[model samples]
Target chain A: MTIEHSILGVIASRPCTGYDIKTEFEHEGAGMVWGVSFGSVYPKLKSMEEQGLIQNYRTETKGRMKKMYELTPKGWEALHKWLGELPSYPSIKDELLLKLSMWDRGRPEDRQTLIYHMKNRKEQSQELLDYYLQWPQNGHSSISEFGMLGIQYVQERLETELRWIEKAILQLEGEPQPPVQDPYDLIPKQQERRNLAINPPVITVHPESSTDEDRV
Target chain B: MTIEHSILGVIASRPCTGYDIKTEFEHEGAGMVWGVSFGSVYPKLKSMEEQGLIQNYRTETKGRMKKMYELTPKGWEALHKWLGELPSYPSIKDELLLKLSMWDRGRPEDRQTLIYHMKNRKEQSQELLDYYLQWPQNGHSSISEFGMLGIQYVQERLETELRWIEKAILQLEGEPQPPVQDPYDLIPKQQERRNLAINPPVITVHPESSTDEDRV
Candidate 1:
């Protein structure tokens, strides 16, 4: 979906200035799911206004003229139309995964570069995870219950990925194992797979992770 | 990175026709990781040839002309440069998550609509997971060790998400709750968080999942 929908969604909740929208993106859960730049926000806002999806009014806040954008009837109509449609598959594009897929093609020194990158990636996820863990303590103000769900989902995903990266780093550091197994080649029917998916095994975190206490 | 890099990378390994690359995307792990349309592949190939990263020539097979694309030295240089740069964070845009985040704003019936969509999504992932599970039996031919790694990663992620959806469905089905806890708000530093990440919890799939025997 276009950023216009997100912009319209935000305006639907509450009208805000451009800077408010930009800051909301950086610090909010929606921004985590959809990446947008500070530069793209204004151009999109202008275009949204041009399309009559949103309208802006001038406001004086602290001696500065600010343009506040709010959803028009057309914008509300557009958002409802989008919300009625089925969500498409999640669009995932990660350079790290792409680079890792092409691992064998790079030079030996490039391996070192990759390890360094994962280490950095590990650090960032950890930082974010820790910050998310703080939400329970911080008084919930602006976030809706669904927003809280989104935060928890991010925390769980980050926890899983952090562990995956550790395994990947070890695999890269040592001789990678090749897949070897005798044929057991037959996929189950749709109903059977659903039964299997619904009754999944217990979820656990790393033994040493800070959130190990939350392990189920 | 552009699909140009992926095309260049594929051609770097060996020259192939546009149809070959297009088919590779449809059936390969790379395609699952990066979604591209059949329509997109030809236009990208044309632009890459114009930009001098790839060169194409006609070859007649079964009285049909096929344009074969091969990477130029400049293409190799470009691919290497991209590989050298630090990988960026993964870009994710999921309509499901966006719709779910706006759950409070949607009509009550939208909840049922969402669960239906997630069920379809689950079915698709199950189908793909079952397909990947067949890789061991099929004599590994075109896939490298890293490709196998990508497959396993995909399988693991799909497994985790499937379970998450189960909980989410139940949560959606039941009463929605609010957050309430005494504050203990503090984010850890870089070093401590890294140690926590490395020692993450064990991942387990549902008991009913077809891949139960493989769960570790």
Candidate 2:
């Protein structure tokens, strides 16, 4: 549903071929917000035209014929309707979070490797955020004001992730447990053995800060 | 790939029927990390069993037959292999971000509606964070320490989102444009109309904060 509306919205701004639409999404301004492959765009364009939401005309560029699409009245109406409706909740699939969830079940080396990877991730995020901060100087129009805001939003998200990674590394360092225990050893060899029998591990709970309640 | 490792990791901790595995995922500890519907789980389990990564046996309980799965040696090897490998980068498909990208093209009423929806989203995120904060009191074991960290990660993410939304609202409020012009009016009725002649609205660039550079 979002892809359909996003494509329509882009076309409503100006007439473009399917290839043009794909290129626009790959550009810095719209890339992160509405990235899609040629595989998805071609079929959607054909279907939207068949549904009379968009109309296409043949144009010659560089002595080659290309079909360019523009929003019909129906397409404009559909785009407006979508804008008025509330969007569905975003579902996240954070792979790093998935790995972190099971980190305690890994060996000490695995944990170290995870930390190393996280540091690399932190650097990558910083690079992306830096690139986004330069969007204003690139001469994007007032109509792209919202797009710039979206970039700022992503920048904040990356910042938060970097902080979390630092905190996690600290927590791992402060852990009182012995280093490099095999995960298989954490499980008892016999059915009667229990986790508590292995060690009297000290658990540190983060103290609740006053700031925790400030946002809520 | 994460799901396959997640399933193996769960089974390695303890043997369980597919029904039991489903229940575990719906439970508080594992639910957030590896949420999957029965439709995906069942097929994945069948294929994994055929590939010799997992094996199953029938057990009768309460006059009914239940098929339980356990990790084979190969499955254990596979899980460990995955743990040693670097995780894939998380790909986000944020619908709200998508809407925000095109927000400048929306009507005044549409922008107001978006603000309302963002507020609602903020509340929902707060509720989830609050629920996660209570995990320590619920007696999750030391092995779930990483899981607890993951909850904190999500909580911080939600808080960041809320802050961004507030900032976004302020930016929208400070917009100098007149209220409620038809979007079509922004476009030229004549074919030759170029975008720049539409008053070239001033875009207020956000000032760079010292904190932004501190992370990098």
Kindly give the stretch of ten consecutive residues in candidate 1 chain A with the minimal lDDT sum.
A182-191
Per-residue lDDT of model 2, residues A17-77, tens digit only: 9998888777654325647899999999999999998889999999999999877666766
Chain B TM-scores, listed for every candidate in order, come to 0.72, 0.70
Tell me the tens digit of each residue's lDDT in model 2 across B1-34. 6778778767766777877777767655432554
Off by over 4 Å in 2: A29-31, A106-109, A141-145, A173-216, B23-34, B60-65, B140-143, B170-216
lDDT by residue for model 1 (A36-119), tens: 677989999998899988889999889999899866667666876787787777767777777666554443235677788788
TM-scores of the models, in the order given: 0.74, 0.76
True contacts kept of each: 0.35, 0.36
- Residue B1, candidate 1: alpha-carbon lDDT: 41
Against the true structure, candidate 1 has what lDDT?
0.66
Sort candidate 1 into its docking category.
incorrect
Q: What is the DockQ of candidate 1?
A: 0.15
What do the candidate models score in CA lDDT, each in turn?
0.66, 0.67
